[model samples]
Target: MATPKSAVYAASKHAVLGFSNALRMELAPIGIHLTTVNLGPVNTNFFDNADPSGKYRQSVRRYMLDPHKVAQKNCKKPL
Candidate 1:
């Protein structure tokens, strides 16, 4: 599932995850809480905007997450 086109995006997310973990540790001493929701690709217009050919959308349609469900569950409970 790795590709040259996604390397930058993946790397940036990795950086953010690492940064958030470090921040969480630092903030723990002050009783500040942090949460990270790592939801995979959600059903959105992202495909329509990014993939005009619809090939990518078709390929991942089965695995795509539902944005509403994701938001609802996250709002109802913390990780």
Candidate 2:
């Protein structure tokens, strides 16, 4: 899912995902649980700065997830 102009951003996200997966296993023995939610572009003000031109935002508008709904889903999950 790496895009042409987001090499660093993509790498950092991958790094975090790997680290979280490893940490989740390490902590499971102690009854700690970890959850990682991989989401696509979220509908938020972030695009105002990140995509100031609005091109990217417009392109992915239909694919964007509502922030409130995402939050509600995660919050409802049992921990």
On TM-score, the candidate that comes out on top is: 2
lDDT of 2 by residue, 1-79 (tens): 7875678888999999999999999999999999997899999998897768889889989999999887888786743
Work out candidate 2's RMSD over C-alphas: 3.9
Looking at model 1, report the run of 10 residues with the lowest lDDT sum. Answer: 1-10
Cα TM-score of candidate 2: 0.70
Candidate 1 pairs with clashing backbones: none
Q: RMSD to the native, candidate 1?
A: 4.1
How far residue 49's Cα lies from its native spot in candidate 1, in Å, is 2.4
Residues 1-79, candidate 1: write the lDDT tens digits: 3444478778878888899999999999999988887777788997787778888778888989988788778685754
lDDT of each: 0.80, 0.88
For residue 77, model 1's alpha carbon misses the true position, in angstroms, by 13
State candidate 1's TM-score. 0.67
Pick by lDDT: which candidate is best?
2
